[model samples]
Target: MLRSKLTDSPLLKVSRPVSACSRCRSAKVKCDNKLPACTACEKAGREKECTAANDQFARGKERSYVAALELRIEKLERRLGYARSMKDSVALNGPDEPPAGDPNRKDSMAFIRAAIHRKAVQTQEDADINTLVSDFGYLAVNTTTRDFEPSESNMTFARLVLAASTNEPVPTPRTADLPAESTARALVQFYETNVIPIYPVFPGTLLHALVSDLYQQHRRQIRSSEYWLFWMVLAISSASQSRSRRDEHYQHAVEFVGRALPHADRALRPGYGTQVQSLLLLTQYSMLDPAHFDSWHPIGFTCRAVVDQGLHQDPPHIQQMGQDALNERRRTFYCTYALDRAISMVHARAFSFYDEAVCVALPSPFQASSTLSGSTTAKRSPDASLPLFRLRQLQSEWYQALYQGNPNEHLPDITSFIWQKYREMWEWSERLPPDMPAAIREMLELELRYSYVYCIASNARGAQVSAYGKLLIFDHVISYVDRIYDIAKLAENAAVYTYHDALRVLFMGSQFVAVLQEIGDLILSGSSIPSPAPGKVLPPPRPVRLDRGTGDDLDRSVRCLERVKLTLRLYGDRWESALSCLKNFEGLSAEVWKNLTTRQAMRNPAPTGQWLPIPGA
Candidate 1:
């Protein structure tokens, strides 16, 4: 019978047994391993579908499991709701039952009572908000007040903004929590509004009070570099506004900068730090007018001392301190230069002796040392280079100005002084160390050229009366132009050939042409040559050369020639004047650029109807 039943049954043999549902495993219930309809799943009304086995869950039982979980969650939520209602009820009244053995029952009861009081306060706060809205609802206008003074309001606003920006709490009169900037701003505002108006009536007392307030408040609080800069600027403004208060501001500035100098020196990093020092020094210098200062000599001496000290220190030491000693040297040079200029002004009677006396008080170390001690030796010290150069220039200018006229006409004196200084400068140039850098040598040469031209101009007026003087001045002017042309030929760097340098050369050439014209006029006056018609002093005819090689070279040459041409036409219209000046320059230019083909072509004449190339082309 078993064999017959097996033959009638349609069953497939399995290699492995199937797994049961995870839910059944957890519930400890048996499962039927059926492909589509498992016995236990069908009895429970769960669809029997074969799903890929997941290690995390049994197959096809997720939905029923989720439903069962939801029912339990609902029951838990219901219980939580009941518990909360009980808590609210207990809070509204007293505890439903007394604690059996709680030791802190009294404290717990007090805490509950406190909580209830806090809630009552919150309710009152809400009620106040409603009342405020209702009370103010009837007012339709919303406008800011204009009755307040603008300056006072601006200061208040600035203070408030500054406080807010810095995250500092607003200040209260009783708390003394205000920031220094706010206090300073308030003081400044008070002075501007209440004190400045009556400044004419009681300037001294009011100004003193303002200064004191600023010193006590803002000045003390200034710790940053920018703050020091701002303080200096303010001091300058204060000094400018009131002449009587100038000394006070000046003293304040000097002290403030003295203190700030160490910081400024420390702040000098490689690039920007050095620039910062320069700016600070310039600011300090700008504060005192040379004309007004009692003595600039002392300032010069102090500056020289500072520079000497810095230079004496090791580079490593300065580097460690984040300072650029080179820049410090430059600053000292400028200070000395300014002092020398002031002294010249005094000597010339351009400024008062009292003002000049101030400079005399500086220590001898600050003064130019006469002896070539090791420390003062020009060759040994690099710092001495610029100052030495400047001193020479200043001296040359003074003498040149003196030779030009009475050493009293301010402008002429200055010009003559520059010329004398130029002569000395050339003498000094000849003595420069053989090892000097080419750049420095080039600069010295340029300065010498400048002085020479000025010297010629200085002697032009005197040259008009005497044949010897005229001949000497004319020769010197021509020689100076030739010297510049030689230097331009030797310049190997673009910096030496800059447009400004070119312009300077051209200007010197024009001045030479002017002097030549003056000489010609003097000749005309002395000789019995009949004068030409009015406004018709025709320049002497001479061959004109217009072919410069490249556009730029051509342009520069033409520009220089044009200046001579214009000056001759305007002053002496005789073609002879233009011809003489042009011939001299053209000859010098040819000698300088003999190898250049363009230069040779430029020396030749251009075709008719073709204009000369413009300058700076």
Candidate 2:
């Protein structure tokens, strides 16, 4: 037999809302849909327990999640302020306050009393606030604290993160014999020379220890993290050295990665400190080998791991921890932070967390472990990564200001803001340590140019960019494309170049095409650009001699565009996803490429029509 039950309360005798509170629904009873607490719950002494999931959803999701969180926090603060005021009033007037364990203290917050004569009466809003405040403690999860053993649960945080981020699954590893001891040593040496200088995520000695444990003794039980560290170093070193996917170096990289995957579940076990290191190693390899894993995902996961375990915050005091361990922790956080900023900027996405969220200080330079005597700290580490980390901080500030800021919210005096950012980055470039490695210095220089163009162009709500601003963008992008093209042409990577470099080239090329499309004639006319009238801040001088000796500006533009394409093509040789960059840029600028070619041949070309006008230009 079929039966029907009423969805709302008939016993209330008045109009009823469509749904029942959680307490009523569980007891199969009618509920009058009073907010904060239902009538049935109140009658049953369960008013504090009343909840409606739908109401929470409808109200909580009405605006942006971040905005909503902010609003709720503000409301909570106001309530706390009111509570403080009430306590102050009591101290001044001697009004009796609720004692500890007062029945009302458990059921609701007290101090609604104003003075000795006024009686306390808690409103529904107070109850509502009390219930909502409890929600603040909702998410108390630590990825490193949970142990999902094979017997307990099939899922692990690492698998969950990989499941989301993996574009192409890492290939199943072969159970082949390990590489010769010398071969393994060479890969480690290359990594120390090229990669470790910029990303000292782990101490140099750890990799060596893992190697000795694995290659020489083969007697000790190795942890999952040890296996991950050894293989990922081999993979990243091999892949970075590989110029072509079909090369022997690339083949060995793929093989090493296959060997590493078996341990990822354990290595990436979520509630442990080792997970961050493992994720970091994977992130580095992903940057080099985008065909198997997207660099973006692993870095995001790594940042979350760092933040979850409070690694983003510096220690309270030196006496609480060893100096080496504290420095390593800080270095680890900054490396993840740097990667997050760089990746987000290249992709034009929001950072996992803003610069305001990170409190860790820059770490001391970490020198590679001395191989001669198996002792590290032979010479103070060259401060290469420190500069890179600083640049990311600078980049994050302006990138968030110019690009990530609200599109509808106007930035006051945007021109001065951009110029100021440009100047700060330039000064940073000038102050780079004299002994910084050539390749590392070159990367930072490229980053500087990228920042200059990025900040000058206002794609969001900002002031109109004058012709001088467009000229600034044109000059910087021309310099950027020229340098990246040279780097791409090298037979092997000097520093750790990755697919993101290709993306950076593509970004710079787009700006190059944009300026040429908007103000091609004036730029090519080689007319001197007037700098903004000096205010409290000064505009950067027009790029000196960078564009002077070039061919006709149109010719330079075409060369820059083609060089951008070619650079991506070269990067594509090592990382397949870089070819996607090549493809995307080719599609986007094909028309501009053709137009520049067509217009370059003419002795005098008239203004081209129908280009998307630059937002503020």
Candidate 3:
């Protein structure tokens, strides 16, 4: 009688389908693919979370995920078109009879529908490409950039939809509450190695002192606002180094930031060492996160803090403080200056700290021991920061003259200044210690070359230069491209490549190379030729290699682009900009590839419209 009752159960009578919902499939459980939610999800009390993977399948053909998305996109596009037509009709033929629906409402809905469809397509494409390239080990799937300037009503609606669509709450990191000494030490080491060389905000001795205090449970020191700021700094710095642990570290950093924000007003008080240091760290962290892409805001606030403390000006009341205080003030001012220039360049904004107003000199070389404090006055330290700062100043000067120059006329007055700066950069490179690691040397060289490229590119845009100047600029640009390719290849080895390395330069260089390739393709296909201005010398045609084993210049250009893409993929986890730039490069490459291939197919037409494989194929 019990066997009969068990056999009669409806659950036993019905058989589950072979295919399952994504969640149930992953969990190795059976699923009933009900619309909107599955039975497995209902049983597990996760009905809302259930999502079928039907999009990965197709009827009457091999399943193509991209194809499925295309079908949905087409449907949405038609619906949006119909909605727009209705909206236009309502606007033009303002209803004689009361309308059934609001025209404005209809238009907004249509706009949002179309925008969401487009976003979905883009997201799917990015995911496909990211998955394809994941074997390279570091490329990230692109997400929508939230930083675009919106003006259209439809755009606002789209943004609203985008924000509303992602309702999942961000999980607060558990690591934030724990002060793991081993983790702290590892992060400190990462910060010192990868971050500090370029942006040396913390002195070694001071950092050591802080870490020691934190560990010793010295509540008197650790309870202060300074400790929180320092902790946040370490969190962000460590986060920047590790791709796998980045999100966790970032969450920890965010928690520390929350704790520290309440003390901002107090910290920003005049001559507060902890306040200035915290601001600097926060500014550096901002550059890594796309959510806070505008580094200028924080850096501006820091500059104001610096001014309030009179760090820009040499301390007039010199005898009151110790040597260490004076040195720190100088260091802080320069650090702010460097960051100000970087942010200005990135955002194309004006610098908050002007060079002429700065009277304080570079800081003396920092010593690791507390006992090594001495009055080193005007003696410039051999620290890399001093030379690096000088290089940045030169870059700033070139940027001002080139980027900020009048577009209508060529600024020849700064030509001599440009050469002088280049010469100085070259001399500095030569002076770099021969014992320097090959990777570091390459990094510095890339920096110098990028500056050179910028100088020429800017000058090329001006109307004042003669044809000869244009030719010279072209030559210099080509040289920069060649060097960029070399450096990009060098970055492939993970042992030498670091998250802290400059990716912006590589992105810019890739773009420049892509443009050149487009030109080469057109020229090769006889669609375009170099059109020089009056009395200008046309650039010589790029040499075609007789050795077919080594592919043409266009192929080489593509290879260079690939190298940059690979580097971006590796570093994207740590820096949002890296991933964002990767998306752009990939898009550009696809367009270029399509254009080139289309031109090639046209050149070699199929006989009578039916295709046949050529001898090469």
Compare candidates 1 and 2 on TM-score and give the better one.
Answer: 2
lDDT score of residue 326 within candidate 1: 41
Over the stretch 78-99, how does candidate 3's per-residue lDDT look in tens digits?
A: 7556655654554433223333
lDDT of prediction 2 = 0.70
Q: Write the per-residue lDDT of candidate 1 for residues 278-394, one digit (tens) a residue.
A: 333332333232222222223322332333233222344334543333443433444444444433332322211111112211111221112121121222112224434354445
Ranked by TM-score, top first: 2, 3, 1
Reference-based TM-score of each model: 0.28, 0.72, 0.57
Query: What does the lDDT read for residue 419 in candidate 3?
Result: 53
Candidate 2, 1-617: lDDT as tens digits: 00001111112111112245667777887554555576677777988888753443343333232333356768767876675567576633334544333545533333333432233323434444544433322322235444344344555555655654565666766666778887887777777767777888876666766777787654588787788788889998888878888999888898999898878888887667788888888888887776777666677667767765778778777689988888988888888888888877877866766666568888877655322221222344366888899889988888877776667666777777777888889899899988665667777787888888877885666567888889988888888888778877965344467878778888888787788778877777878778768876788887774656767777788788879888888888777777877898888887777776766546554467745433112
The runs of at least 3 residues in candidate 3 whose Cα sits more than 4 Å from the true structure, single-residue gaps closed, are 1-176, 221-223, 244-271, 316-323, 367-382, 405-410, 413-417, 437-439, 459-507, 510-552, 586-617
Clashes of each: 32, 7, 2
The 0-to-1 C-alpha lDDT of every candidate, in the order given, reads 0.36, 0.70, 0.51
In lDDT terms, which candidate is top? Answer: 2
Index of the highest-TM-score prediction: 2
Off by over 4 Å in 2: 1-141, 368-381, 408-410, 546-550, 604-617
How many clashing pairs does model 1 include? 32
